[model samples]
Target: MEKTKVFTLVFKTLFFLLIALFFSWGIWNGYFSMIFTESERFLLLLQQHLLLVVTSSLMAVAVAIPLGIFVTRPRFAKSEWFVLNTANLGQTIPVIAILAIVMTYLGIGFNTAVFALFVFSLLPILRNTVAGLNSVDPAMKDAAKGMGLTPMQTLWRIEMPNAMFTIMAGVRTAIVMNIGTAALASLVGGGGLGDLIFAGINLRDNAYLFSGAVPVTLLALTVDGLLRLSERIFIPKGLQEAAKSA
Candidate 1:
């Protein structure tokens, strides 16, 4: 198991480095510098685009977590399946259509992008939160009750801790998804790195394309790495080992 984990981590690290090197090659090849003379523009674009990703992800987690908790209760379980299925279908809907409709209704810009990204970010967290909470052993709940813990206490002290790993996994997925979807925000004039991409496409400039594409890819990988680090830091080692064995 240790060997497998070491191998996996090495593979992932190498993969990330390879991608970064590829993008760096493009950037070094004068592909990105041809269009943008100001480094600050890239920084500003990163700030704006990353802001959208962070906000949308937070909104999804906020709404999904509570609904997920509510649905896990015995009273809501049966009907909650409907909500879950709805979310599943929401995932299946084309993100482009969702973005387009949102842009039309909201009249363009960041807000439309937020709405679209938020919707796109919902499913993984919602479904995983449900699944994670449900996967907690019932015996743990029973034990908590026998020990005189209230429902809230049982959830806070027992269920949530056990489910943390899965919830984090969902969050990681949402973050990566949000990062990718954010590029589409440029379509409706959200002024993201996508601005570089669309401008490139419009003028037939590879430099503009590389400018947009490289940054977005780096942003996704960076967030993914951070989330993976969070998982390692937060998840209990014993639980991780057991999970690996399972």
Candidate 2:
């Protein structure tokens, strides 16, 4: 098992190295010259994209986790179906359509984009939170109660810790998806990497297309990597081992 783990690690390292080299080659060959030629503009768009993703994702996490917790509670259990379905409705709608509806109300720009993305990001995190909490071993909760721990104590000490892995997984998924979706913000004059991509399409410029496309891809990968690292650092060791075993 240890050898297998090492092999997997080495394989992933080499895979990312190859991808890095490919991007480096493309940059060196001026395949992404627009990124350098309009460095200021590119930077601005990149910043806007990052801001949209971060703000929207944070909003989703802030709302969805607590809402998920609320709906999962015994008192609110009957409402879970309604809540899940409502969130699911957001997912069922096309993102572009959602953006259009949001634009109708919010007009346009960063706020509209953030709201739309937040809606898009809610379901995965909410669903995962509920599922994660539900999956916590009943025995553990019972034990916590048996030890005279209060309901809140059981949740904080026993349930939350165990549920964290799945919760983080949901967060990672939402953030990565948000990174890609934020590109669409440019459509509403919100400004993002999509500006370059769409411009490239209109003008038939590969450089512009690659300039935007590459960065978005890289951002998603980087965020996912960071989140994975955070999971390793933050999640309990026993939980990690249990996950591995499972």
Taking the tens digit of each residue's C-alpha lDDT, what string does model 1 give over 50-70?
888988899999998888888
Task: Give the residue spans of candidate 2 off by over 4 A.
Answer: 1-25
Q: Write the per-residue lDDT of candidate 2 for residues 1-246, one digit (tens) a residue.
A: 999999999999999999999889887878788877889999999998988998999999999999989998888999999999999999999888989999999998888899999999999999999999999989988889999998899888888889999999999999999999888888888899999988888898878889999999999999999999999876899989987999
TM-score of every model versus the real structure: 0.87, 0.90
Model 1 misplacement above 4 A: 1-28, 34-36, 236-246
Model 1 vs. true fold: TM: 0.87
User: What is every candidate's alpha-carbon RMSD to the true fold?
Assistant: 3.2, 2.8
Model 1 gets an lDDT of: 0.87
Q: Identify the leading candidate in terms of lDDT.
A: 2
